[model samples]
Target: MTIAVVWLEDDGLWCVSDTRISRRGQGGGVQIVTDAGAKIYPLNVECRLLTVERELYYGRRYGMVFAGMTAVATQTFATLSGMCQALQGASRQDIPSLRDVATLLSKLVELYVRDFRASTTLADPGVIEILLFGMCPVSRSYEIWRVSDQIVEGSLHVAIDQQPARTGDVVAIGSQVSRFQEILAELKQKTENTFRLPKIAVGQMADASRGDVGGAVSIGICNQFGFQTYWSLGLTPHGQGARLMFGVDLDDIGWVGPVVISGGGMA
Candidate 1:
């Protein structure tokens, strides 16, 4: 499980999530499988059409963050991304805005559950939840909508029941929420208005996950351009001196490391 926190401050919508994906080890304990996978997707769509001797372009975006089963999140987003492509050559009425998100996800989640169960005998995946943030095309204001899916049979169910956060509110979703309380409590004692201090609150919550959640915390903010990550870059040497570049989401102000320009590659 990983943490995703969303809060509203002024007119800006802020969201943060850890990138960890974990599975049970051979010893039946939690083992981190990957720490670099992204849970927050900054989707920007620029739909273009070719006409008689001319080209037209339309652009928009919706930023989203997810928590819970990685498989579930991936399946849901693959469909959403496809819709972004269809925005081309369409009227404004066809563009799905922040309000259409919940309905769209409801259809995708139900389809995933029906097809997944039809194929596998594996245990049901817990709730796959997402917080979609962007500008309401009609209202011309920032908004965040919460969507969740859960599969329940005769007996088994696992998930986080997150209340829909209102404007000027904050909510944290994850399996580790209870576990992080003591840590946040201590941190809150030191910092006044932790919710207003998203970087501190989000960082402490991720660290409190121990192995269950640890990764570059992906934080995003809503703007006129839609949802964009508060992003930075990281570089580290490979086997030799050549360094690889990685996009990292910044929880706080990003710090730059050494920079080198190489003929063959980045250093």
Candidate 2:
């Protein structure tokens, strides 16, 4: 299980998620496999995605996180990270926009799900929820997007939704959903717009969370400068030789471990 939160702020996007990956037992219990899995990914100029829309509009500088089948999400994200790295040296004027990047991701997910379902006996590819937040160069506004896929009624379901937040919005998705409402309400009451509340709240929850969620958090931000990922809350480790995220090295950017969250909204 995972505890992922994306708090879209007026200036940028603050995000966090637990890094523990687990397997469920038939008896309705959870087992931890590892606590060092990378979740939040920071993308920058090291990657440039080329598109016909490049000349039309520069896309979003965004950060992404996912929950669900690790293999599916990891594999897909690996592809994306590579695209980012390859285009890292490309001219910014020709990069794609949030809409184009999102569309490409949706198509990739659908293709992966279909291939998996056909090649394996598994009914589906399992649930996958990917959260992308950042600034759209065109609108010059912050945005949050979700690309998700799963099997329902023996059919595949893929959805891409645009959910840009304003002050007082706290978006939470993962193993514990109902458990977050009260916390969100209390935080909102304390502060109308601030990242501190959400960050502290998520830390407390993760510390006290059941087997459904565990491990240190990975945090990051996406704004005018692009994605900046942290191995932990406000901490970015350096000099880690060629650390890989989902099987791709982010241009030797110092990275290992999970991410953090400090979600809040502002006008």
Candidate 3:
């Protein structure tokens, strides 16, 4: 399991996630084996689709952060990425709404669960919960949605719930939710907590969770200026590449030239 946190600050939207991906061993034990996994996908120029003329076209400038079952999460991300590419090539007004995105994801999870149930005779399909965060271009705000699938009435039932972040609000998902709440409460009690960073709180929770949640913390910020990586593991190469190709440093503070939101009228 992993941890993902999303919040709205004065400047923009902040997202943080741990890179630890665990698995069950042959002896029926869980193992924390890697720290190189990415939990945040910056939906900017890096993920753009190329046209037949070999020209690059921009998609939505946002970040998608997730935490849940690895198999399902990865598959969902792949499907979403494909959909984003398709949307980019479609009509300019075809941009998907936040609810549309959530619904599509929920349907994907339901279909996966249905296929699993059909293949296995087991009564329980187990529990799967995926938390998704992204910026809604139509609403111009950061939204968090939870997609949960479980065995209900001996069949798969999926539900998608959405919450829009307000200024100073904190939202968290995955194994470290409770821990994040405790830290948030403590921070609220302090009189001088205005300058605290969300990444620091998430990093502290990951560190305290031992191996349950760990690895280098990855962060992304999205707002009117567009989405950009605040910090991430092994980001130097990516930063250099962006600078070379886009003429903007991905690591630079307040850098807005790296990504362009097409048809949304925000350049």
Best by lDDT: 2
Please, what are the lDDT tens digits per residue for candidate 2 over residues 1-39?
Answer: 577888866476788777678877768698777756777
Q: What is the lDDT of residue 5 in candidate 1?
A: 76
| Candidate with more favorable, higher lDDT: 1 or 2 | 2
Per-residue alpha-carbon lDDT of candidate 3 for residues 34-119, written as tens digits (9 for 90 to 100): 65567777553222334555334445566677665666667777876676555543434545666677787788877766776577
Candidate 3: where is the Cα deviation over 4 Å? 25-29, 44-58, 88-91, 116-127, 232-267
Better of 1 and 2 by TM-score: 2
- Per-prediction TM-score: 0.72, 0.73, 0.72
Model 1 C-alpha lDDT per residue in residues 137-203, reported as the tens digit of each score: 7667776777765555653332223344456466666766664555556776886765555545556
C-alpha lDDT of residue 164 in model 3: 57
Model-by-model lDDT, in order?
0.61, 0.65, 0.62
Q: What C-alpha root-mean-square deviation, in Å, does candidate 2 show against the real structure?
A: 7.5
Q: Give lDDT for model 2.
A: 0.65
| Total clashing pairs in model 3 | 0
